[model samples]
Target chain A: MLDVIKSVLAAFFGVQSEANRQRDFQAASPWMFIVVGIALAAVFVLIVAGVAWLAAQ
Target chain B: MKRFALTGICFLLLAALMAGSTYAASINTSTGWNMPPGVTDVSREVYSLHMTIFWICVAISVVVFGAMFWSLFAYRKSKGAKSAHFHENTTVEVIWTAIPLVILIVMAVPATATLKKMYDTSNAEIDILVTGYQWRWRYEYLGEDVSFFSNMSTPRDQIQGLEEKGDNYLVEVDEPMVVPLGKKVRILLTANDVIHAWWVPDLAVKKDAIPGFINESWFLVNEPGIYRGQCAELCGRDHGFMPIEVKAVPQEEYDAWLASRRDAAVAEAAGADREWTMDELMERGAGVYNTYCAACHQPEGQGLPPVFPALAGVGMSVDPEQRAEHIAMVAYGKTGTAMPAFGDTLSPAEVASVITYERNAWGNDTGDMVQPSEIRDLLGK
Candidate 1:
């Protein structure tokens, strides 16, 4: 799970090494990455919205 | 020598950037260059956001073009350099995409904040319903019983180039929408005929006025001054003629102005009750005709052919027997035609006068006169 979160965060930034890409693709199922990516995306949106709300205040 | 050349290039770029910043700062007040840091807090924030994003783009372009040019010159054919064939280089692609994504996230932060502030139109002190017509704007103060139409005050001769144009040639209006300074003024926008946009740059309020749909926008003026804008949408032939003017005054002055406007509206309503003489109706009718009717029917009563029929000594005007038909045509316009019903747009007095004027003027002398009371009776008002 920790490795999956790390890989998803790297993917969110669009920055992943060749070794990491090979490892991620070699994994049996993409379900882990997919689930993690979606969860991280929602968190990213909440963080941005929170910052905006604070700045407006 | 190569290192020296690179250093010289960097120095030149730095100098150019410095000169540009100085020039932009100096020309901030000039209308030709850059967006104005407008009179309200939101407007100023918008301006700052614009500049921040603009500078980010400038920085990115500098780095990108610099690298591109340096690589181009350094690896030219003259230097015995050979091109490498590569596709889908993951590292380079990732770096490029990652940098842009990060930059976009940074840019979106402030923009979202400003957008939220702009959309928060709650607790506004004044609410005005702004309705757009074919070539005019009608401002109705909510719960204030003060409503009036603002028409362009620029003369026709200037437009035709027969007379010299004034400084505010196309931007002047007969009556401006007045607001109190330091108070939030929310405007509910809609259109009676077609889509039109109300835009005032100083207050940074621009929103569309669509038929059967109401859009909400708000502005709070920081300073007391007159700001002018025009209909930002192209609705019809006379789109360029409709202008918007907003005057921001102190609270007490605004109260006084609103009171005076209420009195004027009362007086105008009273005009409908009295018996108006022919001369009185004719004079008022001519003004109304020029403002509302002259766009389709020409100033001399000879309208454009086919699309707009001539009103002078022809059609319904000359036919004394078709008097009621003429009145009905003016009051409730002909369907499936460009002639819009002035029943809702014009007052009873105005409709009566224009009809009376069309019957009497342009040698269509039927010696006919329509009264406001008769029109009121016909409309059951």
Candidate 2:
């Protein structure tokens, strides 16, 4: 049972670790994720605000 | 474990905050969201159907998502969840499918009824032919001695965002469609060129006005109020400038309005027989031109490039014999071109006034005052 759990964890993290090892991964940069995340967050905020406003009306 | 727990708590807090804020905001404006006086049976039906569907969706989402989230938290891996291997349950599959089928049947019955109601525009009490031009609306009360053009009353400065927003803003119009309450109003909608949609959301009616084809819709107002809407179609450059205002008044008020409109039409026809001074023609002509012609021909009499031919120094403007042809073109329009037929859209006097303005403006110096009677004669031919 413990070995099965270890295998599953390894399967999940192994792919990520291999991808990170490649120098091509550096091309995307950390700021790209932050920028995209912020944009998505702003849109979510706006949608929530609009729904709230409509409900109040 | 601690990190995972913190992330879950944070997500829950964020969701709760967002939902709470939305709920609070909505409570403040509940009454303002009610449907306006529904003039037509179809509009009222549509409003009811909209509310019905909205609530149904809300119920469905709550039930489905509620179960989903409950399962997610209750059966999380951290809680030592065990996977159930009883995959093929025919009873469960049948029950789920049957339940969804029942829900769809309930929704479909009302939706179909509303659709059938929306399609019945026959045997209307009054018929009005509504034509959409580039940036204005023309209304003709069929079989009645009443027809007029309506244009944006808001000044150019306000449209360009130069002036502070006025009370009406883009909702202002020089003339509004006035209809009597408790009468079934049938609207025959079409466009002079391109496509436009006549929509009044409060009335719960929207019908596409396509060029070369007539579409019909009807509405009956139950109460008196000033209801405003905008051109819902993206027709062209000045689509946003076109707004629709309908005043539903008592039957007596509507009768008074109709009488005045008839009087104006009669007065305009009578004025055509007289010899008008150049000043009078120019004053009225300028106003007519700005409202009807300026959108495509431009305020300076310089037409839009490539599509609309320049009126300034054009052969049609200077030649005396070509004046009739010019008037005909403005009235009947050149087919397969951007120039829409103004005959159906403009009153005879409006056509005459615009022609007079075009002939004299941009130093054409034609000094001609085309009479509405002349236009009336041309229209007959």
Candidate 3:
């Protein structure tokens, strides 16, 4: 699960290594990465919005 | 080492060239190149945000392109430099991606802040309803009962190259929307027909005026000045002809201006009840036609047909029997056509004069003088 989170973060940054990508694809299922990616995207939006809100004040 | 020294010299030369251009750009910054640090707080903030992003882009370009060129020259194949076999270099990719993400986030914070400030139309001292027509703008001071159409004042003679163009030219307008300096003025924008965008660069306010929908924008001028802009959206044939002029005055002057406009509107309303002469109607109608009808129907009633039909001869204006129909057509425009209903836009006097002018001018002489009272009654006003 931790390795899945790490790979998802790397993907989010758009800088995943070839080795890590191979490792990710070697997994039996992509369900973990998919779930983590979605959650991270939502969190990113929340963070940006929070920054905007704070700056606006 | 010799090749490396040559590459270093090339890099230094490139840097000097960049520095020279940067110096030139800095000197020419606000003349015409950069966005105007405008008259309002929000506009200034927007300007600063623009400049910040611009500099950031410049920095990124310098770094990225500098490294790229340096690599190309310093490791040329002719210099016996062999290519390093690499795929998906982790640290470099991560560094590049992380740096850009940080920069984007930095850009977003200030941009979002400015946007929020622009959208905050609350507690505005004045509310003006700005409605975009085919090629003109109508400004209605909400709750103040003052309204007027602002038409491009540049003469057709200048446009046709018959006369020398004035300095203001196409940017000039007959009436400018007046607002008080240091007062928050919110504008609710809408269009009568197609879409139009109200854009005044100095105020940094550009909002679309969509038919059947209202878009809002606001500005608070810190100084008294006249700002000019054009309809940013292409609405129709006379899109280039339309212009926006905004005059920001002191509070007392604005109040006085508003009062005078109210008095003029009242006088105009009263003018519709009285009898008018053929000469008076013709003269007034000529002005009205030139301002309103000339763009589509043309100055001499020779309209660009297939879309805008000519009103010169053998049509509604020439036929004495079709006088009422002509009046009706002008009052309530023909449906599914480009003709906009002038019942709401034009005064009864204006409608009467324009109709009379159509009959008299351009050899479409029907010897008719339509009265404003007659039009007032026809409109059930």
Q: What C-alpha lDDT, on a 0 to 100 scale, does residue B353 get in candidate 1? A: 91
- Better TM-score candidate (2, 3): 3
Q: Residue B78: error of model 3 in Å? A: 1.9
DockQ of each model against the real complex? Answer: 0.38, 0.01, 0.72
- Model 1, C-alpha of B283: deviation from truth (Å): 1.7
RMSD for each of the candidates = 3.2, 14.0, 2.4
Worst 10 residues of 2 chain B by lDDT: B28-37
Candidate 2, DockQ to 2 decimals? 0.01
lDDT of 2 by residue, B180-230 (tens): 998988999999777998988767778899989999988888878877888
Please write out the lDDT profile of model 1 over residues B60-122, one tens digit for every residue.
988898889889888999989999986457778877887888999899988988998898999
lDDT of 2: 0.77
DockQ of 1: 0.38
